[model samples]
Target: MRKLLGACSLDVFARVDPLELIAPAPQGAALALYVNLLAESLHAAGRTARAQANGNSYGETVGELALGLAFELGARQGDWDAFCTALAAEHARAPAFWRQAGGEALLRKKVNDMFAVLRDKVDADNYQVACGRPCSPNRLYAYRMLDTAYGEIARLFAGWREHTAQVGAILGRPVDFSVPIEVRQLQSVAACRPEWIMRWSESLERFGGAPGPLHTKSKRFESLKNSPDKIADMLREIAEYEAISSNRDSGWLHDQDTAGAWIEDYWRVLDESAHGATPGPDLILEARTEELDAPMVEVAQAAPVADDDPLDAVRAQAVSLPPGFLSAARATQDPGSWAGRMLEDDSLPVRLAVYLKLLGAEDDCYPDAWRDPSTGALPNMQQLAALDAVSLPTLRKRRDAAIARLEAAPRTGG
Candidate 1:
C-alpha cells in the first residue's frame, strides 16, 4: 500500500538493472513481470495524481523495492531512451510509446505478467523463509490455483440458498444455505471434491449463464480434476502458510538494514546451490519413501541396545541443546548450550559437517564458537574433514546423511 515514489524524476532510476538485482535463482517470466509492474507504476504518475485530486478516494502506492524492481524490468522490456525522450518532449501527457497504437496493450500485457508472477514468488518465499523448508516455484503456482478453487467453493456455498436447485445439482442434496456455514464443515479439501468443482462449473452455465472455471478449455485447473489428495495437501499447506504469513514481519522488505540482511540470505542460498547443497527431499517422494520404510522402524529400535552405540552421547547432547550455530572453540566460561549439544551428538565429524552446512565456512556470529579457542572462527570443509580422519567426500556424505535424518525427525512443532 506504500506508494514508492510520489513524484520523482526519471533520471533517479536510470541506473537500475532489473535482472541483476533480483534474488539469485532460476526465476521465470512471472517474476519478471512482477518486477516490471513496480517500474510501470513510476511512469503512470498522472493516474495517482488524479486519484489524489479527487478527495476521499482510496489509492495504493507501490512499495519502493517493487518500484526498483519495476525500473529494472522497464529498462529491460520498455525502451528507456524512448520513454525518456517522450518525457522530455512534453511535460503533460504520457510518453509517446504509451500513446502510440498497440503500445498500451503491449505494456499492459507485460505489466500483468510481471505482477502475476511476483505475487506467487513472494508467497512461495514467504513459506520457505519462515518454515526453514523448501518450496519450488511450481508449488507456489499450485498453491495459488488451489486457493482459487477454495474461493470458488466458498462463493457457491455462500449463495447456495438462492440457487438451491443448481447447488443441489452439484451437492446432490441440500437446502441449507440459510444456516450459517461453519469452518469445521469446510475443513478438508475433499469436502470440495474435484467432481464437485466440475459439476459446479457445469451447473453455472444454467444458473449464471456461463460455464464454470474448470469447464473452460484453459487446462490450468484441469490438473485438479483427478488429484483430490494433492488438492487436500495443498489446501492444508496454504492454510498453514496463511497463518505463518500473517504473523511474519513484512516490514523487513521495507527497512534498509533488514532488507539488506534478507538479500544476504538470498545470496547465501544461491551460493549454497552453486556449491551443490541439497534443499531437502521432494515432499511427495519423501512421504512415499517414509511409508515404504515404516515397517523397519520397530526392528531398528529393538536392535539399538549396543554398549557402544556410536555417537549416542553426541546425538543426545546435540538433541538436547538449544537452537543457534555452534563454533569449534570451547568457551572459557560455559560454552553456549548449542555448542554443548553439538558436542554431545557424539560424532564430531558429522556435527562439524552440519556447522559447515548451516553457518557456512565462516559467519560473523561464529566468533564465539570457533574450533580454536584462540580464533573464534569456523573452519572450512577441508579442516573439518581433516579433523574427522576421513576424506572430504566421506565427511560430506556423513554430514548430509545426518542432517537428512534430523530434518525428517518429528519436532515438538517448529
Candidate 2:
C-alpha cells in the first residue's frame, strides 16, 4: 500500500471533508480502517492504480461514493452505456412509484429523489449487513441509515401507524397486529406455513385489496403455503437474473455470494464469538509497531546487551560447527519444505528472515533482542545482530541475499 501511494499518504486524503450526502457523524477511525483494508485487498488483487486512486480517504472511499451515486441515478447492471440509456429513459417520464398518505405526492417525490443518491452510495452487500434484511429498489427510498431494524422495528411500526391511512389503503382497511395473519406475511426463515397462506386467502376475500390483480383467484397462492425459506432459496437461485433485467441492471448491485454467506454465517459468528475456533499457536513473534518506520535494510547499531549473553556464545559456536552439519540440515530442507529449510539455515540473516517470513516484518524479535518476549520463538533480531558482530542493515542484506539465493537455487535431491 505504501509503494502504491508513494506519491501521497492516506493522511492527506483522509483529512478532506466528504460530500454532504453521507450522515452517520463522519466516521474517523472506522472510515480510515475500512479504507486501509480496502486498499490492501485491492492491491492484493493486483489493482494497483485503482487501490491507489482512492488514496487514504477517511470517510467513504470513492468506490462507496460511486456505487451510491449510481444507485441514486437508477444505475443497474449492464454495459455502462446501455445502463445509462435505461436510466435516462426512466428518469423523468414516470410518476413517483409510491405516495405518502397525508402528505402531497411531491413530498414523496422529493424523498425518493434524495434516496436515490443514498442508494447509489451504499454498497449493496454492506447495506444488507447493516440492515439485517434485504434491500429492494422499491424499499430503498424508505431506508434510514441511523435506524437499525432489530431495535428500530418500533420506529418502523410507528411510521406505519402515522401513515395508517396509507397502510389502510394497501390492506384495504385500517390494520394492526390483531388485524389478522393474512394481511402481513409472518416471516419465517426456512419455510412458509401453509396455514398462514390459507388464513391470508380467507382474509383477502373479506378485506379486499387495491384495484389491480388482488381480486383475481389463483392456485398460485397455494404454492406460497409451502414455506418462505424455500421461496427465499428459489429467489436466491434466480437472484442472478437481475443481469437479464434491463439495459442498466447491475445484478444484485453487490457481491451476492458474499452477502448470502454473511447472512447465513451471522448466527455462526454470534455463536462462535465466545469460542468455536481454537486459538492460534502462540507465534511468540510478530513485527513491531515500528516496522512501517523501520527499514528493510538493516542498521549496524543496537542497544547494548550483557557480555555474558549465552546467545553471544552460541553464535560464535554456530559459525564454527562442522560444515557437514550445515549441509546435512540443507539436504533435508526442500523448497516444498521451505519452512523446514528456514529452520535449518545456518546464516543468521537467512534464519532471521525465515523468522520474519514465518511471523512478519513487524516481528518483536528484531527491534529488541533475539529473545521474543511475546512468544520466545527465537532470539530477537537485536540479540542476533549483537552475536553476529554485524550491523542490523548488514544482517538484513545478508539475510535477503541468502533468501534470494535459496529461492533461485535449483531443486536438490530430497
Q: What TM-score does each of the candidates earn?
A: 0.39, 0.22
The numbered model that scores best in lDDT is 1
lDDT per residue for candidate 2 within 1-414, as digits (tens), equals: 233222122222234322111223342433333233323332243333543256222232332232223222222222223322333343335432122243234333333344344343343433343334676543332222111211122222345655444434434456664543422442321123323223333344444452212124544333344454543443332333222222211246345444433332332232233344432323111212122222122234344433343333333232222222223222322332333333355554456544453344443324333324445444444334433444333344456555454444323311
Model 2 residue runs over 4 Å out of place are 1-194, 211-229, 232-286, 289-414
In model 1, the Cα lDDT at residue 55 comes to 22
Candidate 1 contains a number of clashing pairs equal to 17
- Please give the CA lDDT of all the candidate structures: 0.44, 0.34
Error of 1 at 274 (Å): 33
Candidate 2's TM-score reads 0.22
